[model samples]
Target: MPAHLPHGSRASAACLSPVPWVWPVPGCLSQGAISFQFARPAPPWPAMPPQAQPADAGRRVMLMSLTGLVLGCAVPLSGKRQSQSAWLRPPGAVPEEQFLARCVGCGACLSVCPTGALQPILSSSRLDALFSPQLVPRLGPCAPDCTACGGACFSGAIARFAVEHKPRLRIGVAVIDQARCLPWAEGQRCVVCVDACPPQCGAIQLRPIAPGQFRPVIEPSRCPGCGIREYRCPLPGQAAIRVVP
Candidate 1:
């Protein structure tokens, strides 16, 4: 051709042959692999609206109901502290309502009862008295030695275990139902309640009425107020010394 090298010459770029231009000539490769190796583009963001979260009505109701259910179950488990019955209570404890609320009533306090002093109130009493513990001294009397029913009542019915230490609780003050007692009404020779007393506190003391017979009377200062288990006293009405608030 004019001034250019021949088309077959190595000098001609298109016709160059075994020149070994690259030290290690790369093999034929797919463009897809090269593309895959490149960095990816960033993802597009969603376009959701910024709405305010609504209050969960169902969840609130569930929580309220659960709270109510727990409180309902706890009421009876603590024994009838709210009950009108005098027997089922923490002896000597003040601010009774608060004490009973925290009480576990696990019967642990009932076990340390060295004396059978803390007896259970039986069916002979009212229905409200059901499953409640009363101090019954049928076999003997409230052990002069053991008065822990007060201290043991983690519920705080009374303050301490020792009756002496315990500021005299008006648990159930004895009322000598003159209408019932043998000396007062029936005029018999019965001195059971008087003799049954622990002697330290002579709740039922005898007074020489006639020469031969003595009438049993309650020394208001002495009677602890808890009723009898033997069902002996015969008040014309309910016991004169019935439990009161």
Candidate 2:
């Protein structure tokens, strides 16, 4: 016969037993006795072998290659789009490809522009055009007699020339929109563009059309495309005259 023991004492004895023991209580005995012990934390999950790491390395290489491919394809397309747009380069600038190759993107030319017409090409999808100098005639017209941009260009992107040679250097051509010109559209007398044009090149001429009515005509051969006519046009929005390269 076993010695009689209180319920709490039996529970304590059962916990202390060297061999695992389960409480006889119906619900408590379902999973057998609970036991605990300390052992080396199952030696840290074995380091991923060198062979396994190649999968991760390959993934990184593939990602880098894809990125390069995307950039390569995008660059040519961006360059093509830029080429098709009207880009008004400063006077004395070389041919498109040569100028792009020679230009160092220094702002020297921009700094020396007397009329503030030369502006930096700040934003462009093509990386090469970024920071290159361009002419924004609406801000201020390039002085026909000034050779500052060519003189300031250390990169030879803009050829250095004397003031005398500037008349022959055609950076772009000015086109008049007859639909927007006041004289052409409304039959009004307007010679603002002709008056503002540099006298050295009589590019814009007022031709007598009807009784006391005159229309502006462009003489391409004499025009240097200095942008004076476009800048001085009196129309409210979008000047009647525009310069295109």
Candidate 3:
């Protein structure tokens, strides 16, 4: 027997001597080259260190702090006393302060609006105004003849009246913005609002301002202030003819 070679040692393939310790290394040698290679399997990956686990304490603290801040802010806002909003009330509605006390969030007026002009007041400075009915003229004009909203209100907030007897339903008055009105500012012949007014009510009329020029004048006494003119105004942003509470 040939002398034993130490581990990882190699003997030439050409060597005829009996070599009992030859390690094969693919392509390490030519057909007659002599070489040896020994490779131990990479040590198993080191066990995950304790530091590898996530430190979620900071995240939990941040979430808790954010939640606390929201609640803290909300508590003060909700606790503060608030008064009724200065928005226009539905037709036949009582005075503002009294209306707030009498009105319930029943959406009765909203359901009976013939023109769908009545909408629930969803947000206001006062929490009590959340569900109050207000006319959204932009959605639809308040019909002069429709008394459905007043008739449906049983809470006495909105007083009911007969159709023949015109209800003094002055929710708000229309104000003209001379700078935006076509005839007043641009010298254009725009009679949209004047034509839209109810003939019987004669809420608006063209008054001669100069020899040839005329400006529309609103008569508060006869004007129902129904906001039909606001819906009919041609200008953008705030209407040239706007209904104000």
lDDT of each: 0.49, 0.78, 0.75
Clashes of 3: 0
Task: Give the Cα error of residue 158 in candidate 3, in Å.
Answer: 0.7
Which regions of candidate 2 are displaced past 4 Å? Answer: 1-85
Best by TM-score: 2
Q: Is candidate 1 or candidate 2 better by lDDT?
A: 2
Where is model 1 more than 4 Å wrong at Cα? 1-85, 88-90, 114-141, 147-158, 162-170, 226-245
Poorest lDDT segment (10 consecutive residues) of candidate 3: 13-22
What is the alpha-carbon RMSD of candidate 2 to the true structure? 8.7
Q: Least accurate stretch of 10 residues (summed lDDT) in model 2?
A: 19-28
Model 3: residues with Cα > 4 Å off, grouped in runs: 1-85
Query: What is the TM-score of each predicted model, taking all chains together?
Result: 0.48, 0.69, 0.64
TM-score: the better of candidates 1 and 2 = 2
Location of the lowest summed lDDT over 10 successive residues in candidate 1: 28-37
Clashing pairs in 3: none
Tens digits of lDDT, candidate 1, 196-218 = 55565667777898898788766
Ordered list by TM-score, greatest first: 2, 3, 1
